[model samples]
Target: MKTPFIVLEGLEGAGKSTVLQVITQWLEQRGIDYLTVREPGGTPLAESLRELIKKDWDERVSPEAELLVMYAARVQLVNEVIKPALAQGRWVIGDRHDLSSQAYQGGGRQLSKNMLAQLSDMTLQGFKPDLTLYLDIEPAVGLARASARGALDRIEREALGFFERTRARYQELAAADPSIKTIDAEQTPEQVKAHVLAVLEAQWPS
Candidate 1:
């Protein structure tokens, strides 16, 4: 089987971790070599940038700065990690990818689409995942799950309104893009895993 880049996208506590484990198990069963990566991470410098973005700062962080830092981390990871792994015939399973930026920075921060487009074009250069699985969950329910994980990060600490907008954008993007598949994440983990496997079999069957 050809190696394809696959990404899992979701708001916080959308059970992406559980779904990811299902995928890993599926891949192992198929004897496929795969690597896992997280956006704003995967590489040393990118991990550092991730910490900067997630950490609480005394001074207000400019939205533009936040946006640029994310792109910076993305570029590093794409060049240093994802590309290399793909080149070696290893499939990549990404925790989050560019869509997070479109939803979070573009929708939540209300950044200009033109600016987002330009930055994305410059950084990604048309690179994209072959398949994207979106775990769609309501903000309220997702937040409740996230809160149980302890203190929220900077982005997670945002008001409910922010996440609402982000979820709206995620749905819009999935609806418009054929490569993105939206899963009903509010379902039980077993049900969600079954849905995920169905999508994988339909889209990337052995």
Candidate 2:
């Protein structure tokens, strides 16, 4: 089998940073050659798009514009960074992936799911993560945690209802996809860590 493309996904403040550390440590101990990359980033063009998307502008940003920019960044990252890394037999770990666009744009922004699917199929050509660990948390709780982390970015500053819709779509999609698994992010840190580790070990044991 090809080297797995593993992705960690969740709303803001779901402890993905902590989980990433755990994953990296585990991979390092096993001497696994791996590359970690975040969506809307991991390359010069993609990182620039990330900055452009995050920076607040004076005028109201349309949902269509946001969605297009996200896809542009994603395509750049996939072509420039992710695919080559995987082809070289390196484990690719993504902080977020295409699923985020489905939830945030299709569900949160109320865009048509068919349009999102068409774009996904066209851009990715059926590429997908081998294993996606989705940290599930209530929007209110997650937003509260995010707010405490300091200033919110352009997307992060959306209304609570937006995140609620996003969370719903995440749950719906995770339930339907066998490769995606949900971890209860409301648990204590230690507990959540244990659950994450357990899932990781189950899917890709040493």
Candidate 3:
């Protein structure tokens, strides 16, 4: 049996991480084999890149630089973590993936779509999520939640308007892609968990 590769995506403060935890617990309760990992930091090399990408605020990072670094980390993660786990038939849940670049870089940074497409094609190498759960929340609500948490990262510190554009881009992508399922994330954490479980049951029955 092939492993189920699942990716969770959403704007910051969409509760994606919490939802991931709940889904992991659900799989554990069912006695299912699985692995949970986040992009840009799944492997040693990728993790190193992640630190640089998220930190070192002195230099203004260019959109192209961000795109290249992201794909570099992703390539390493795929070769080191995701591929092996799948080969062993362990379900893999990722906190984020390629769509993130499309939303953040393509939409937020206003990078060229063609350039992103080329990078994605080269790095992904035909591997895509079997199911992508996109937690949808209004940009304002999500940003408020994020700000309430405390200090923000480089990307997290982007203006609310930037996030609004990014969120809109995500919704557009979800609407166009059938494999991506949008979940309302405005609800309480437990309620969001329930919605996720229902979506998974409907999509992939056990």
Q: Best candidate, lDDT-wise?
A: 1
Q: Estimate the lDDT of model 2.
A: 0.92
Q: Please, what are the lDDT tens digits per residue for candidate 1 over residues 1-206?
A: 65699999999999988999999999999999999999889889999999999999999999999999999999999999999999999999999999999999998999988999999999999999999999999999999999999999999999999999999999999999999999999999889999999999998778
The lDDT of each candidate is 0.94, 0.92, 0.88
Q: Could you tell me the lDDT of residue 22 within candidate 1?
A: 96
Please give the TM-score that candidate 3 achieves against the real structure.
Answer: 0.96
- Model 3 ranges off by over 4 Å: none
**How many residue pairs clash (N, CA or C atoms closer than 3 angstroms) in each of the candidate models, in the order given?**
0, 0, 0
- TM-score per prediction, in order, is 0.98, 0.97, 0.96
* Weakest lDDT window of 10 consecutive positions for candidate 3: 54-63
Ranking by TM-score: 1, 2, 3
User: Residues 87-130, candidate 3, lDDT per residue (tens digit)?
Assistant: 99899999999999999888888888899898888888778998
- The runs of at least 3 residues in candidate 2 whose Cα sits more than 4 Å from the true structure, single-residue gaps closed, are none
Q: Write the per-residue lDDT of candidate 2 for residues 5-59, one digit (tens) a residue.
A: 9899989988888889888888899899999999888899999999999999999
TM-score of model 1 (CA atoms): 0.98
Candidate 2 lands at a TM-score of 0.97
Return the top candidate by TM-score: 1
